[model samples]
Target: MHGSAASVGPAAADTPSRGTLDELDLALVNALQMAPRAPWAQLARPLGVDAATLSRRWARLRASGEAWITCHAAPSQVAHGALALIEVSCVPQAREALADRLARHPQAMSVELVAGSCDLLLTVATATKSSMTAYVLALGRDEAVTATRTHLVQHLYQDGSEWRMDSLSRDQRRDLAEAEDSAARTAAAILAPEDRALMFALAQDGRRSIASIAAELDRPESTVRRLLHSLLHGGRAVLRVDTAHVHSGWRSSATIWMSVPPAQLVSAGDELSRLRSTRMAASVSSEANLLSVVWLHTLDDLARYEAQAAARITSVRVLNRAVNLRWIKRMGRLLADDGRSTGFVPIDLWAPVA
Candidate 1:
């Protein structure tokens, strides 16, 4: 509790196994998803585990790089920023190296090697529209790729925060939910100096205790607590547990683009967000107005998901499917080929284009 996640990326590992997360591990993950910063004592009762045991399990998982919790700027926190998805067609010989190079960019929220029409798909955000333009122009100038296409996100209907592991019982989930203070929820937030510092601190480890954070900042515990609660409950930031995708049994992810009638765009986005597999759902600027990313057990799962989507939204038409082969950098964390956490690059959403 006194240390930072600088040691292990949001630390949860396979359930004392070599291959995959076990039922207990998944339950823990689900618990964190519902209340990422809950105290061990608070979370343990719902899982029927002792606080000491729960802490030990999380340590093992974090040490193994199987799973961990991290935070990122929430929509209200980045009301002034620009976000977009860019698909790149790369030269076969240079694609691998280029993906790694791009993954290191502070502005790149995610960079994935993909199949289908694109070699790489980048999710980028910038402080301003001009910076995004600069980023696009620089991307086009890079000699590693043949062409690039960009999709600007217009409306964010859903994000990773809403994705949860269905390993907990309804009573367990309700117990966790009841612990939250509803009065803390805020529709908007503006960052102050302390807020930025707190945000950066949480970006490193969302589960850091108030006492630990206050110690790190050399500030009064009450001050740090106030800022932390405001940042989280006020919608200035989001904290979520993330797992190494490949090892988590969700072996692959895909980017799907669909055209929806203007009248139905909002409903379509809502419908897509309901799919358990959906990682992100948004309204975007392109021939296909609705863009979605989904996690899957196998590549074949997309077909069934597509059928489900079609049935859910009558007028939607899928224009393209890009299979994400590997998450080179998911959110702000770097990943190995097997999807283990290698390190992190704290996402600087407003960083200038380099």
Candidate 2:
């Protein structure tokens, strides 16, 4: 539930300080990771803080541009077919133009300017194989794009890599359990060190059995079972939702770029969300001019979305729709960075109920 979109590697250390996050901050973040839209008062209450402080901290986090709340969807479940990671080699000067073009595409999930092999890494999903092929061919037609390499996502274990939330301590865990007395425990905390060791091993191969986990963790099979169940119900920590790009029926998926007036954004976004085809939409900060990204299931669905947008926002731009050829690796790292995920939690996604 706690999600991040961060740059990894050596520069990862050079990243700016995240500021001091105390017990309350950690608690609030964990609550939000579970439900990003939870009410300020609700999150505040459990942490023994007031609404004002919670609101202030949240605003600071947002203002600092270190944390955000975004929606994620299962493309296959939405009837979109393929998924792909695109690497684009472009002239540094033209990178801005290329980014702008890709961001407008309805097929892209996320895009970033990297420092390595490819200047840009674009995650795209599409509806059908034919559509995916067409989308790629269109990119080839772009004169600005010198070369492109597509990596089909075979499977997704994790997505996003921002670490705005802090890890938890033992006392903090007890406090959480006490505060939310009736809530289910997170799956990550149930494992012993040995069990966790096994989990790490099994994560590399999802098919790893309890016996294997036990052997790896040097624990008994019974302990492994208990830990596995805990991981399942405890916020799904040990295992995550796994799916291939093209499953039984769904064919592909795509990212939709949108432009909206600053004034009309709230109202326009609300209206667009009423459509069933839209899985998730968010206002993002990008180097390109585009302001928003929407995930859609089908091309017809996309057309309908455009019509709706025309009535809501002043103008809508369809940059380029990339196809998701396959799913690559997904969320797999330890949350707390202590070889355990006990202390790491994300904020809730939806607002708390009255």
Candidate 3:
């Protein structure tokens, strides 16, 4: 189904509610967006609310489509090759259908409809230059996709804080190049098809041992170990992580869209990267000229960070803040191009008591 093109904003008091969000709702939503694994107790603590209350609020938010919580592996991590940001210019009338189609495609990492020169922004991953060309050609086949332009991700300048902790304090942020030089180099070779198949199998059940992966792929254990070493070294992929969140206490989270002046983007973003609560920050494709999205751990932190970033950077606009209410999908394995499931497990949350 097509999502509404309407931008989010508060309306008149007397008007019937299209959708109304409360402060607590925003805080809870933001918290879950960052760590869907956080327990009810931890989520409740910061708000001075009980776990039961947090659970009740979560249920209501999910019922409304205000947010989605899903664990998604970076596209290149699961596949090999390049990741690109593609902007689509479409007839306003056809926007809905275009968005819906793109949303269902397996290759889509994320999609957003915006107001500006382009209507849609898509994050796509492909294995080779030829595949990238084929992908663009495929878009041309769709009537709704009128015109498209793309930017290859020279590097993932920033991946949002959703999946990884990007916003670590000065002492907490470690230099990747220094920490894993050999692993990074080896990961390039280990990301082959056989290796992916092995990973795909392990992804389903992390408890599976090297022997198990070897048996499944009909490869020797030594070979599997070698492949895994390469993957770890290359930073191509990571083993599954056991994640938890704050039902034990109070916490909040937010996704902030910022418009930065072109000249100040690098310096400004680097400064933001040092904050304690920022889990992730990335430059993304937007219909608006907005340059970045930052994830925060709490509403208070979000407010403070925005004020600080705004003060330091004069070149852009912080256009929209979407307080993600709840995440519907956690980690789940996606289907490979061959139609086999990747064995990704969604972080399962225990149902809150009534």
Candidate 4:
């Protein structure tokens, strides 16, 4: 049986959870949520643990496939690019096979099996709108796929990077904040053309050392460090520590589409952002102007969110809500049946879909 740490929120303090991880592991994941690549030595002091012990704990967590870290091109920097959510319908009994097939594609950022009108849900990113259109057309050609509904994202109000575990102390957060701000300020807010290769390398393994990345890029360690510092501090890149949500008590999620008055879109988005269950919320160019997703302890929890959203937000009409069944892939990592990382596909949002 899965233990209590898998329980959403938290169990009582007196409850002992023989779950996949103890309190320490959760704390580590929380700290990484703040500074994913902070040196072990720097992180140790903040967590009140030694560098060596912290390293060993991370090793165990990674080896068990209970947790991992990865980075992505920041949504803000890539706001000009084509990013959309596609609801996919498959032919009879072909959902799982098609989901697995699409999950391996580099442009398919995250693929989920769902319970609703569509058999699969896909989040795709491409360098241009035309390229994304071409990819969708290509998908329509697949014999297993019957229908698809695409929603072009208009604006992102919140993303997974902003979600935190809230396990760190004030002092710990202060230390981590200082580490993130230590980089020398740069004039440019986004990565230059040359930072592309380095950015993708970090996407592959977010925790890779500066020396390791330098060797891969065939550059001096000092130069690599400077570029990395700018890329991170400039907000052109995002690093997040994500576990298999199935293992985290947040076993299910729901995607909500809404039609809100133009006057209330910003306020609506802001309201949705502060919801505890919210993982992502954005404005989309469709009949439904607002789209949001929420994590829940069980499949039934979607109703509670829908009820609350309808009552709280101003004039928000719920167009539809679909419950996600399985995350076949997330942020380029393909998952196994039990939510463990089996492999990775290097996502390339900078490239046109060919």
**Candidate with maximal lDDT:** 1
| Ten residues in sequence with the least summed lDDT for candidate 3 | 1-10
Clashing pairs in 4: none
User: Tens-digit lDDT track for model 2 on 149-185?
Assistant: 7755432322221111234455544545533312232
> What are the root-mean-square deviations of the candidates from the true structure over C-alphas?
3.4, 20.4, 12.3, 6.7
When sorted by TM-score, best at the front, the candidate numbers are: 1, 4, 3, 2
The candidate maximizing TM-score is 1
Output the lDDT of residue 98, model 3: 80
Q: Against the hidden true structure, what lDDT does model 2 obtain?
A: 0.45
Which regions of candidate 2 are displaced past 4 Å?
1-27, 75-80, 161-165, 170-354
Of 1 and 3, the candidate ahead on TM-score is 1
Q: Write the per-residue lDDT of candidate 4 for residues 1-354, one digit (tens) a residue.
A: 100012122223443333556677878888888778878898888888999999998776665566787777777754656889999999868888899888767788899998888889999988678888999999999999999999999888888877887677888788788665322222235556756778777875689899898998899999999988778767777776887676666778889999999999998998898888988889998889999989887878888887777777859898877788778888777776656666677677655544
Model 1 residue 196 CA deviation (Å) reads 1.9
How far residue 111's Cα lies from its native spot in candidate 1, in Å, is: 0.7
Per-residue lDDT value at 280 in model 2: 40
TM-score of decoy 4: 0.89
TM-score-better candidate, 2 vs 3: 3
